[model samples]
Target: MFIRNERSIKEFIRYYPVVSTIIIIHILTWLLDIIPIGLFNQLYHLGVGSHWGLQNGEYWRFITPIFLHGGLTHMLFNSFSLVLFGPALEEMLGKAKFLFAYIGAGVLANIATFIIHPSILYSHVGASGAIFGLFGVYVFMVAFRKNLIDSQSSQIVMVIFIIGIIMTFLRPNINIYAHILGFVVGFLIAPLVLNGARPYYPPQYRKSYDDDGEIRFDPNRWKKKRFSRKTKQNFLWTIIIILVVIGVLYNVF
Candidate 1:
């Protein structure tokens, strides 16, 4: 379920519009921030998760920071995480429910951050909270709703989740409160939205065979071979390793 089968960016977007749109927004806002025109400086000042802003009734800060990032590395890391993880949930929960869960987790995480850090100057940004929320949903599926994911994917989720939790504590400037609370919120909200949810199967790889008495006729043949389960597992593990290296580098620099 964690494997991505899309051959191109267009196909990826077509299959997973919600994840695509969120990533697009991340890139756009990040571009705005770095454009050197100072046009979006107000966005940085107003949209960051500032306890001061929340106290003064700028409630949108909760939602806005989910789409904002502090730098290229910040945006790319979260976007890569989403690209790797978000499609399965989007496919399982449907677009609307997936959006609800994502935004809900992020907003609640920001609220938790505000409550946990009472100082007026405390502020945070990035979608790490929301990304952790995605991990939370996977954790719920892996633990309570086993049928929703396969054994391999569950192992991947648990490994990544554990690594993520460790990194949350190890990384400097990390918003521990947002990450933890977002995960909790996602775990709690999973049952409400996951009714009738099923494991993800990419449309392109779906095939059916028609039985003609003793022989089966395969009607849907593709020029390219589909990925083996082992191949996908290896690829995912490679990504996990790369993420670990990146996380370590992030801590160093």
Candidate 2:
């Protein structure tokens, strides 16, 4: 989707302003820590940060804090995830839809954390929720949109996704629910973007995959151009449902 090569990096910066701006903003936001102490707080309260207080009248909280972070590691992990997952999703959906999905997932995930894990002294900050949204978007596409990713690649991606989830649970200080909420939001809305995005693949490539992810094609199934909407719904819903269940149980016991 996005080439990490030097030429492609320049292209992304020039062409993909939304994603580029997001990456830039997140980096600069992390650098805010180097500034004086109370200065960050002064800037944080201009109705940009999301917390339970968002419901009281701070509407911009839905979008602003997507740029903020907690520490060097927090910012780096999220920035890496965004760079990894964002380009293709952004390319597939176009800039507007891409940005909408990013912010939408972030806002909803923040709201979930606000509702479910509020604290007076602590705050939920970071782009992991939004990055997880991109994470889910990629996973949903690979699973349901046949040949959007080949079987072997998709299997590897799922393994990586599972590991990320496992790591999320290991960090008790983090708001895991926010990540789940963002993932679910991205999964549900991916189909809408797919409809608008043009298809990409090698025409010579056969549509082939067995239940176990081995390449076993049925001619009847391959004849179709793309999977049906119902198929997309079923696949993404099942993944997110399983994820949410695991997250809930993790929090509970």
Candidate 3:
């Protein structure tokens, strides 16, 4: 007899909020490409490869490159992976912390790329470096929580890393160095990002049972919970909208 042990759809959804958000952004970016507006393409041109490395200027390129993309396929693949990995990481680290980690890793990856290929005028785009960083973080988390060599997660990550290295050597356009650097940085930062997170517990079990058999988890019963699904959704949407607006503005002006 076959036994299905899949998680509930709701549970799957909860584990992938960040991933869904990234996918939405990717779809939006793709849509912008087909629209009559020339804004997204223009914004992309300005954003990528705008950093200064050993050069005398263009210092902002280090951070701006992460927002850029070379084409629809590039953005789609990168964003898909982001969605796959980002939510899991974010849920573990909290949305705010995850955002910081993503942006920080992306910026650092761009910097590393710029340092390595400073004089290349060609624009570098896509979220590969940042996504790779998240991969690193995932691997690190799994390794920390389980056996490094024997764990299925760690083994899978190792295979991915090996494949990435091989692809880097095989492909002329791939940014292998950036991927490597981002992975290292993400792995290094995972522990810090995940510090002090309460161990996984069911929602119902999260509440405390006092000696009197009453719920005693609340420090101030009068005060509302600090964070919830609604709060997280609102915060996520706000950031997405702001980023979209910025992209639009960049295209128009």
Higher-ranked by lDDT: 1 or 3: 1
Cα RMSDs, all models? 4.0, 10.7, 11.9
lDDT (tens digit, per residue) of candidate 2 on 143-232 = 788657556446645765786688688757776887889888888887876775644332233354444634444465445536665776
TM-score of each: 0.91, 0.71, 0.64
What tens digits encode model 3's per-residue C-alpha lDDT throughout 1-253? 0011125746545655655665666666556555676886665455556543326576676766665565665665566456434554665577777877777777788777777766655456667677778777767766685521234335445655565555556656767767888887788887877775433222322345645633334455325435665765565445444434433443343
Q: Rank the candidates by lDDT, best first.
A: 1, 2, 3
Scored against the true structure, residue 43 in model 1 reaches a CA lDDT of 62
Instruction: Please state the error at residue 82 of candidate 3 in Å.
Output: 2.1
- TM-score attained by model 1: 0.91
Q: Count the backbone clashes (under 3 Å) in each candidate.
A: 0, 0, 4
Best TM-score goes to which candidate? Answer: 1
User: Per-residue lDDT for 21 in model 3?
Assistant: 63
Query: Candidate 2 overall Cα lDDT vs. reference?
Result: 0.68
**In model 3, where do residues sit more than 4 Å from their true spots?**
1-16, 34-36, 51-60, 147-150, 198-253
